[model samples]
Structures are given as structure tokens and as C-alpha cells.
Target chain A: MNLERLGRTAPAVPLLVLGLVCLIFPLLVLLHISLQVRGGYGLGNFIDVFSSGVDRAALGNSLQFALWQAGLCVVLGTPIALALVRLKGRARGVVMSFINVASSFGGPGLAFAFMLLIGTTGVLTTIWSQLFGQAEFPSLGSMIGLNAIMLYVHLPLYLMLSLPSYALLRNEWREAARMSGAGFWRFWRQVGLPTLAPFALGNGLQIFMWSMGAYAIPYVVTTSPASIDLISIEIGRDLESSVFGVERAATLSVILMLLAIAMMWIYRTLQRRGERIL
Target chain B: MSAQTVAPLASTGTTTSNDEADSFLGRWGALILLIGFLGIPLLALLVFSVATAWSGTVLPSGYTAEHWIGALTSSDVLSAVGRSLFLAVAVCVINWILVIPAAYVSVVVEPRIRPWFQALAVVPFALPWIVIAAGMQLTVKEIAPGLFGTVGLLVLTLSGVTFPYLYWAVENSLITNNAKQLSEAARMSGASLPRTLLQVIVPAIRTGVMSGSLLTAASVFGEFPITMTLIGGGYETLPLWTLRMFSGRVPGAGAELAAVSFATFALLFAVSLLITRIDTATKPADPVRPPARIS
Candidate 1:
């Protein structure tokens, strides 16, 4: 395989043009919507999105929820992924498949099922009452309930992303640590923790983007007017509620895209630093 | 779930006996974590699907097939399943076409451009499917107005989302195996590049290609946002159909949801098993990493 041969095969112009167009179109549309005003061109929409307290709150809440959910997912998912890649035998296969399937699980239907489980008189609450001898159902409607479900929804992806790196840790390293008389805490801190950090950060950032941008999980699980109103939900609500201001939704879409891009850049930089350390 | 929670001892102690115990703990630790984390939720889902009244209890009061029966009869479930299957197959075919040529260049044609092509393939992988859904919707609105709500739209959207998986699988196959040896073996016998690619390289990576396709199918089949936002009211895939079933009315809706989940899981599980077989078969028998030299 050679570069000269690749150049000779075709001009490469068409491919380059197509790639650039595909990459740029969505961002351009977002910018266009963000800058446009009532009847003409201006920065009013952008100003409105940023200046308005509600819009700012929604953006803040979205980030907060995304961070919490993604964090929880990474914490929970890493061990499961570790088990899948490192463990063996019949039982392992069954567990692996179950996690794989559950990772793909959820839709609006899942959101609704969770709603039933965690909501008032839901299965979980009912069980809680029976255990505690409570007369009435309790509320689980704060950020914790919403974020927990969101974490569960995104756990599989985080796990999948983190599994390879976790698997990359050879068994010999563990054996070496044991032979050296390193205790559980020492082995984890000196060998395991350092190895997994970069992976966790890279995977965490991706999970953060997912949790932040996801519309369905939050839409289904949370309080109306969404106590932790994220940007995606706002965009959807605007699209559904507004008569002709589809542009507003478009404007928010731009903001989200920019945030995602920025977050990814930061994530990659962190990964690069991690690579250097290793 | 297993009560076993033995942990591997860190490699510090001198005794062979201790090392043996550590090995046992490592294996058992993995097993316990697998059951506790993954097994429990899945078991919960299965138990709930069968229980006539799962509410108000840690365990289901009783078991029944009413949910399975309800799912079978439900028009929503049937149509959703049908649509999901169709979309997944369509995505598999479309991605396979784009990937074969791209992978060909990566492996057989030009090696220097390989890194760039591989990077381009993975670029989309880094982006969430939701971004693609949003981008696809916007791109469709501007490019081809009529294609927006059709099956063609769904197919194309899923293809873009899944292209990387297919590319990585096919490319990894090319890089890992004795491609140059096979191609040189063919070339010395007077086969053209295209012939060598189609006959030798294609067959060589067939396992990788199929595994990639299966992975793509599982992802696209389970995908929800693309169906919701892009396909809109016209197309009703399994996820969308399940969503409709739960969102709307009909008796025993919970049971139907459970049934669809089971069906979806079974279908994906079968696909994954086939992939696992192909992957293990394609790899070299020796456990060591293959030589780095690409053809």
C-alpha cells in the first residue's frame, strides 16, 4: 500500500469535499439559528439564550445532572466490565450477556417502567413501606431519583468504553503485586488505580456528553417543568410548545453541539496527558 | 446471586500457598462481581416479567406467561419487532458496502493513508448516536426533503452511526492476519489487485466482517432516538413500537413490554453468539499478539 497509489486511484477531491460538508453543515445551521433575530440577522437569540435566567438554569441543571449521572455510571460500570473481560466460565457468559442486553435496554418505555418503580406506590416504594412499616408512600422526586435512572440508562456504554483498558491490565501485574506482599489497598492504589485513571477520565467525559445530551431519560423520570431542566429537554419543549420559533430550538441545539465539542477536546487532552504518564 | 466475595491478594507474600489462594480469589472475585452487578438486575427484569403481582414485594408473588401472550397478540409489539428487524438488516447491508471498500484501502491498497482513514472511521464513534440523530434530521431536511421520514432515511442514518464498528472489525482483521502473505501468495500466481482483494482478502476477513455486522445490528435494532426524531410518525420500529405500547393503552401493557424485552434480548444474544464463534475461529490459535507487519 502506497500514498502514490492512493493518489492515482482517484483525485481524492470528492471524498475530501464530502467529508468537510458532512462535518460542517450541522454546526453552520446551529450558528445561523443562534445569530438570527425576529425578522433579520442579529445576536439577539444568542443573547436571549444566555441572558435569560431560565435558559441559564436549564443549561446549568443539564450539566449538573450529566456530571452526577455519568460519575455514578463510571463508578458502577467499571467493576462489571472488569468482571466481563477478566472473568471466565459459564456463569461469566450469562452475566456478560445480561449486562450487554441491559445496556441496550431503555427507551421511553424504560423511562416509564422506572417511573412506575420509583414513583409513588411504585414497586420500590411499596417495598420500602412494607419494610419500614410506613402508612403512606414517600417521594423520590429530587435530582437523586432522576440522576440515578439516567446513570442506569447510560451504564452499559460507559462500561463498554472502559472495558478494554480495564482488560489491558494483565493478570501478571496482580500476581506480581501479591508476590511483593502488597495488600488489597496497596495493590489497588499502586497498580490498578493508576492504570484505570486515564480510561476512567476519557470514558467519563463521553458518558458525561451522553448524560448531558440525552432527552428521553430526564423527560420521563423527572418533575414537570423539569426540576433539573437540561438543554436537550429545553430544546424539545421549545419545539413542541412554540408555534413558529423552531429557530429557538435550533439555537439551543447549537449551544449543545459546541459544549459537546469543547468537552471532547478537553477529554482528548486529558487522555493525551494520561498516555504520556503511562 | 452468589454469596462468594473472595478478593485476589496483591502479589507481595512469598509463599506459593498464598499465591494459590490469591489466584482463587481473583477468579472468584470476578465471578461474584459479575453475578452481583449484572445478574441481579437481569434476574429482576425476568422475575417481574413473569410475576402476576410483582408490586409490594422483593420477590414476585407468582409466575405466568400472560405477559408473553399479551406481547404476541399486541399489534404494536409485532410491528415494532418487524420494523426493527428490517432496519437492522438494512443497516448491516449498507454499512458492509461502504466498509468493504474503505477497509480494502486500509489493508490492501495504501498503507500510509491507513491511519487517517482509521481516524475518520472512529470520529463518528466518539460522537453519540443522539448527535447523529440530530445531525441526520437537520441534514435530511436540507438535502433530500422526501427522504426524511422513510425507511431509506432510517437505513442511511444507522449506516453513518454504525460505519466505524464495521470498519474497525474489517480493518483489525486485515492488520492482524497474514494478509500480505496471502496476497503475495495470490499475486505470485498472477491475480490482479481487485481479484486478490475479492478472492483472498475478502474471504480472509469474512469472520471479522460478519462479527462487525452483528454488532451493528444489535446497536441499530436497540436504537430509539433515530426512530423517534428522524423516522417520526411514519415508521414504527420495535423500540418505537414498545414506546407506543407503553405510552398508550391496552390491557397487560406491562407484560407486553417485558415480552418484547425478552424477544429483543434473545435475538441479540443469538447474534452475539454467532459473532463470538466467528471471532474465535478467525484468530490465530496461539494466544500471543500477531506480528505487526501489514500486507
Candidate 2:
């Protein structure tokens, strides 16, 4: 029986090994490069990354981008998610599929969609300047512009993560809260909010993960990356540009991965607490 | 997800009349607002793809098929499309062969390690595209310099990034079809593990596998970053070409770019239909969301 069980599992080993070589080992190589310094391995690269003005600025911008994205999605997505939960059968089906498809779209298609809608001489731009007599449409190359495009991807991603939690919200709970003389906001504050708080945080972390890790939209959107540098941009520059070694890119990548791991750790803590409350 | 998970967000009968109005608006309002927010851009792209000129108007001033013809017939566009298609198809096929057995083993044979399989899929997701690209350059390319800046590398790297989607899709299908019990039955009837999986489990889960493959294909179809950073000067996938067009490299080809964008969307929409059809038709017990215990 043990031999038979081993035979069944054998097919998976090659795939797993391929996954490691293709995905994990390369990452491990980056981690190794990230630690290497002049004449030996140490924290010298990390120190250089921390102290350099440009590197520091890029990391700061990435963190701000991530935090703002998380906050915006949670704030905007809650009402939207709640609204979605209330839809009748047919409408729910339509919107669910729309959200799912929206998440898959990134890179150039999304960039062009944004450009066609909001870029200078774009449809909305052309229309708005005409209607409102405002010639200055929002720039797609600015930090705000970049993040807005980031939301194009991150918002749908957050919805996909958080929408499932709304199923836990029931009409009965609200009805009970009202019967206990609690008003709407009060009920949510006392009960509804608590029930959903962990998930909201979980969803926020998920948004933070994608938002922080995001590269494609930002890469395409920003015209002057120098003024609005993201860590991924820096990493890309170092990887491709001869002025900077691959070490810098590897170091920054490690830092970015660490930030994501930090979020995962926090999520793990929240899940433990959440399991009890839930 | 199950239908009941969408049990309406009802206003209690006791709540004020104002509450009903709020929810009524909120429900339909959300759907319409999202549709308009997301959909108008799509609509505009469609119109622009055929437009002759619309410098400062609410809509296109004129329409023609010239841009569509030019964009579709361009040698650059054709090569990029070929590369993109090859990458998409290859990634989907590679992941298909790899994920099925791995998912079966982790989710069925040894259920305790299911989360590990899931975590593997998600970790790559949380890495920035540049990091993945850099890792590929530093390791994979160095190992085989021949593969550098090739669509072949994109195929291998993308399978790394996208297998998670297929994993979740197929795993959900497997669970929904009760693969463990079905496999046990097949085994008792003298079928080997490979035979049981190939004959019984796969046929049952093909819907998931098909949609999942198509989903990954659509993702690869529009993929940027890795393709651009690694292979930009040496190669030109559809995305790099599109970006070049958008950046005004091609000069007065807005209509062509719009046509290309619209064409891309049409393919994505077509694939989406298959994915959502399964979601709505079979009503999988879980939607496409990532499972719990991770961000």
C-alpha cells in the first residue's frame, strides 16, 4: 500500500522540481545577489539602499502608493460590495462575472483603456473640456494619474477578495440590531462592522499586496518616472541599465518581497483572531 | 460560489421607507455605476477604433475601417500577435500538464499540505513584475543565455505566475466533483491512479480546466513588464508594440492603436464568457476568489 501510494505521488515530483527551478531557485538567486557586497556578503547592500536618497525616495513612494491604494479600495469598495450583495439573482451573476473579468485585464489593454477615456485628447477629456470649458484634462503621467490607473486593477482585485465576506452579512442581523433599538450606523459600529472588520482588513492586505507588487500599469502610465519613481521601476532600471549593477535591482526586489511578507505576517495574526470571532 | 451566498441585502420590514430607497438605488446604482465606469472606456475604444477623426467632440466625427485594416495587416502587429499567441498557448499547456497532478496530490492524496500548494501559487503573485523579471534575468537567463529576451522565457516565467489561477479553478472543480470518493471508487474497480485521474476526474473537471486555461491565456495575451523589461529592444510582443504606439512612436496612429485595443478586449470578453458561463451555469461552490488563511 505504501509503495502504491508512492507511485501515485511520483508524477507530482517533477512538476514540483520544475516549479522550484523556474520560480523558487531564481528568487533564491536574487536573494543571494541582494546580500552580496564588495569582497564578501553582508548588509552593505541593504545599507546602501536605505541611505541613498533616490532609493529611499523610491521606496517611500511605493509605500505611500500601497497604503493609499489599500485605504481607497476599502473605503470605496465597502459600499460597492454591500450594494453588490443586495442585487437580485440575475444582476448578481452579471456583476460577479464583470468583476472577475476586470481583474484579469492589466498591462497595455488597461493602459489604452485609461488613455482612451481620460488621457489628453481622450473621449472624456475632449467632452469635459467642451462641456465645462476646462481645457486642462488630468494628466495620465502624474502620481495621482498613475495611482488612478493602479486602482483600475487593484479595485477589482480587492472586490474579488472582499466580496465573499459580504455573504456573512445577513438581513437578520440588521433586523436584530434594529429590534435592540440600535440605529443603522450604530448597529454597524457595534455588530456589522465587527463581524466584517477582519475581512475588511484581510481584503485591505490583499489590496496592499497587489498594489505594492504592481508594476505593469505604473510602468506604462508614468511618463517621467524620475519624479514619481516606484521601487519596481528602480528595479527594472537597474536590471536593464548598465549604470547600475543587477545587485541594486536584486536588493530592491528583496526589500519589496520583505514588505509583502510583513503584510502576510500581519494577515496571519488577523486570521487567528478572526477565526475566534468568526 | 453557491447562490445563497448572494442572499439579498434586505432592509427589514420594520426599517423606514427611506432605507428601501437607499438600498434600491445602491444595488442598481452600484451595477450601473461600475458598468459605466468600466464600460464607457471600452465603448469609447470601440468607437475610436473605427473613427476617422474626433479631435474635440463628444463622439467620433467620422468612421472608417482603414485603421482596423492597417493595424491588423501590419507585419509588426502580426509578429507580435504570433509571439503573444504562442506564449499564451504554451503557458496554458505547460500549466495544464503540471497543475493537474500536483493539485490532485495536494488536495486529494495529502489534504494536510493543500495550503502549501496554495501558498506556492500566491507567493509569486505578491512579487512585483520587475522582481520576477529580474529573477528570471539573473538566474534563468544566466543558466541558458540563449533563452534571454525570448518569448520562450515569457512562456516559462508566466506559467510560474499564472498557474495559481488554474490551480484554484481546478481544485474547486475537483472538490465539487468529489474527486477523493470518485478516485476511491475507480481504484477499487481496478483502475490505477493515472487512469482514475485521466479517465474519471479529468472529464469531470474539464470545464474548470478549459476556462482556467483560457483565463491564463487572456492574462498572457496582455502581459507586460516582464516582456518589456527583458525583451523590449530585442523583441516586440503585442503589448510592447501597443505601448510604443500609444507613446506616439508610430505618429498619428491613434485609430490603429484603438483598433488593436478593441481587438484585444474582444478576445478577453470572449474568454470571459466561457469563464463566467461556468461560474453561473454550474454555480461552483466557491467563486474565483483566493481561499482563506492568506491575504
Worst 10 residues of 1 chain A by lDDT: A11-20
Per-residue CA lDDT of model 2 for A1-278, tens digit only, reads 48987776776775676667666888899899989888888999899999999999888888898899999889888878887777777656667666766665666657777777787777778778777887765566566777777776677777777776677687878776665566556667888788888888988987887776677667666656334888877787777774778788889989988887888888778756765675
Superposed model 2: Cα runs more than 4 Å off: A1-4, A126-135, A225-227, B1-16, B112-115, B291-295
lDDT of 1 by residue, A1-278 (tens): 36777563442233333333444465576566567787889978878788888789888887888788777767766666665676566654555555556566656555545645665646667777787876443233357766655555566667656665676677778666655666556677888888888878888887787776775555444445435667776665554455536576777777777777788788878777766665
Candidate whose TM-score is highest: 2
* DockQ of all models, two decimals each: 0.29, 0.47
Number of the top DockQ candidate: 2
Provide the TM-score for each candidate, comma-separated. 0.83, 0.91
Q: Residue pairs in steric clash, candidate 2?
A: B1-B287
List ranges where model 1 is wrong by over 4 Å.
A1-24, A37-43, A78-85, A89-91, A112-116, A135-142, A171-181, A222-227, A237-244, B1-41, B51-63, B184-188, B192-194, B283-295
